[model samples]
Target chain A: MHYTVKTAGDQSIIIYFGEQISKQTSQTVQKLSNIIESSGIIGVEEVILGYTTILIHYAPTRISFHTLINTIKAIIMDVDLAKTDERNTIEIPVLYGEELGPDLANVARLNNLSEQEVIKLHTEPDYTVYFLGFSPGFPFLGGLDERIATPRLENPRKKVQAGSVGIANHQTGIYPVTSPGGWQIIGHTPIPLFNPSDDNPFLLSPGDIITFKPITKIEYDEIINSQI
Target chain B: MIHIFNVIKPGLLTTVQDLGRKGYQKYGLSVSGAVDYYAHRIANILVGNQDNAATLEVTMIGPTLKVLETRKIAITGADLTPYVNNSPVPLWRSFTVSEGDILSFQGYRSGCRAYIAVAGGLDVEETLGSKSTDLISEIGGHHGRRLIKGDTITANAVHTNKICLSRRLSTELIPTYTKHVRVRIILGPQDDAFTAKGIETFLSSEYTVTKDSNRMGCRLEGPTIEHKNGADILSEGMFMGAIQVPQNGQPILFLSGRPSVGGYTKIGGVITVDLPKVAQLKPNDRVSIEKVTLDEAHELLYKQENIFKLLQASIGEGGGL
Candidate 1:
């Protein structure tokens, strides 16, 4: 856990763990973010993880800048990097094709594979959640099969429904809330990654593992109806 | 006393806002709040509310409301020609309105937004420890959207407050809303991504705020800022005041509703002291970007934090208005 504290703005400071976006850098950033978040240190408002950095927003009046830097430095040393990595694997149930996934057929055609082959390749790997960004609770997942890689839509959709699982190039992800995107949607999941009303608003965190489980439309409807 | 006001007509875009939502940016949720934080603070101070209290943020146009029983209310930032029962009330000061008195705004005066602060904050449900409205996400504040006709606002009156009601801000402290502003910035966490010539072009060129600009960001049109490589980078954390230059060379100055992370290279970030000026800028406003140091930005911020405290002391003790 060695890092550098760089200038962000007047109200915040950034901790750069490494220069590149690697799993080691991500783990280090996540560890510090978690420590600062749980520290309950007055004046520290937020702790967000980037590829290899942590942007900490602190209130000047509550805690002075000089003191905040000192607090962070002390906390950074407390992060035991040698400890066993903590991982939480969440299974997201997805229903492939039909109205929910309009781009599924297009993706299969582009990849030169049948729709069944595309689904099989997609559901195989255990994707790693690098971070949550772009939109609320939208996970930036890594680890997609190269054979099923597809290009994004040239003209972005005006409205992509929530829970839509999309593939863009080598990246595959799920949209937690309804937002306009250009990803090549292949399927949709009924599980909500973001529920603002709940005490824990986001379902996934950095370093978490996720696997897509193929489910029928009836199962999706049952899960959706049960939640409601 | 619970003072309530019924909305007769909502303005172009009026919504309840406070300081902003914090701690949720990690989840990619926006930190929506008052754009002009300085003005928001002044209005709150005049009405004896906390700086973080929820106030109605009136945009380009203004709102019309029928006042019921209420405590002293203050209108600050962007004059907007606010009136009480056809009588024009001055901005930057607190005033009392009687029951059945109609409060409305006429004309687009100076500045782009205004804040209305009640003696006690508007009673709104808190989401993620904030009362601000996030229109994009549709969460928090008066159903998480702009105020519509027939909507009602209720504030729990704080009767035991000691601050005088007839207080007014001195002329020297009021921020001048200008069409052209030169904002100071601190060169960035990703400035290395840009070439030397690109950095030079950014500092020398004058930019105009485009129409596409909104609460999320101010999209500027200016000379192309050359980059050493491509414009895209590994997505990183972003905050308000971050000046991100996309492939087209133009910059986007992020505002209150900025995303938590972005993939573009950020050349610099506006200083804390100048963000209020950026917030008040209207579309097509011309701007000049200047560079400042980290130490200088911090110094200005520490000085600004004392403005409200100094204003509070200048007001007289409690009295019958």
Candidate 2:
């Protein structure tokens, strides 16, 4: 993958993979991120992975910008371009509609479909977790069905509950923490994407494949109770 | 051994902070630490603690504490009229407190936040290698929330009778807090997204800090900076001190609790040395932004860091008053 390096700040630099978002780009970005992370290169403070970029925050005291870029360039030369199906396919259980997911009704009304029809379409696709952002373990997933796409709320809510499954345009995501958000929520998931106490903390990662499985409210309660 | 302090009144907003939680931004974690890094560092230095020792970050108002044991403590950054048993104490110096001394703060004199560092650092359990509190995430530092009344703080009690007591920082090393501040910035990765007029307006105009400002970020009210095209850009990683101009044209300056990534076009980043000043800005405070080369930013940082080196030698030679 051809990339361009640009200065993000005085101590940080960004490496761009491509203009468009694709699984291939995420693969390349993740590949380089893993290599550099495990490489234990000096001066590297933090390596943040984006959909189509990698941002490296380094200490200028330990290594110069030119030296850091040169080191990345050499590592990129030996990167594997072949795409492998090593991504994890995790199925998430969700309870659709009702109070927790107030916007589900609006989504169906906007698409001129029944609530059951919307649920059917929502569960069909094996969505790709493009990246983790917005909050900890909050995955910005790709591959939402366009037929049920809904726009965001005009005025954002004061606090959207955690575990809220929302849709904005063609994208869908889960809220790991309760924050002021404008996304049109369609459902609630029993499984938390973020658990700060866990060893991994974040349940999803870039390139992981996830599919939403519809479940009853009782089932959701059971899962939640079991986890506790 | 550990020294304990009971919170009689938690004041406006107070939390434990250190340098910040690093290497966790990849999981979208916000680094919620001391906004005034320089002050936090100096407070720790004055009390002979490591740079990353967790300290209490007191906001506009300050907390009232009942000291439970004799320990060395230093207050730095904002002047919040701290008092011990109704008598005023000095800032930027370490002193011994009696077991029952009433440590309290009266009013804000200058700056926005103050750091109180005890000799042995706070003994809070680290969540993800940090004692800093992230209020939004509700993790780390006294249960990831601001200090409340009746809350008790436990600190490691190290004997520091020789090195730190009565050691006041030299006059030249302290920063002056003012209503208006000139902040230096380094233009960066997305500067071209803004128009020449937009860049010119941004540089020329004076902005007022809005009331919505916090540890997360401050929204600036100023001239609308026009973008060359649209205001939105492809989502990418963001950092502290990033001046991101949104669709409304007003710039939002992210601080210590900035999100890991953003989609807005950032015009520039506040220089590292100037970040301490940025953290001290109060609501409605006026700010003038100036540009400097990256080399100058790095040089200023080195110059600021050299103060610690000089202080270490000076303290080692003379010990203290």
Q: Highest DockQ among the candidates is held by which one?
A: 1
Model 1 per-residue lDDT tens digits across residues A1-228: 567886666677888876776667777777778888999999998887787788888877678888999999998877788775779999999999999988999999998999999999999999888888888888887789999888889999999999999999878999888989999998999999888799998999888999999999999999999998
The prediction achieving the highest lDDT against the true structure is 2
lDDT minimum window of 10 residues, candidate 1 chain B: B312-321
Error of 1 at B64 (Å): 1.3
* Model 2 CA lDDT for position B232: 77
TM-score of 2: 0.96
Least well predicted 10-residue stretch by lDDT in candidate 2 chain B: B312-321
Residue-level lDDT of model 2, residues A95-195, one tens digit each, is 99998989999999999999999999999999988777768888878788899999999999999999999999878999999999999988999888788
| Model 1 ranges off by over 4 Å | A1-4, A61-67, A70-74, B1-3, B160-164, B312-316, B319-321
Name the candidate that leads on TM-score.
2
Every prediction: chain A TM-score: 0.90, 0.95
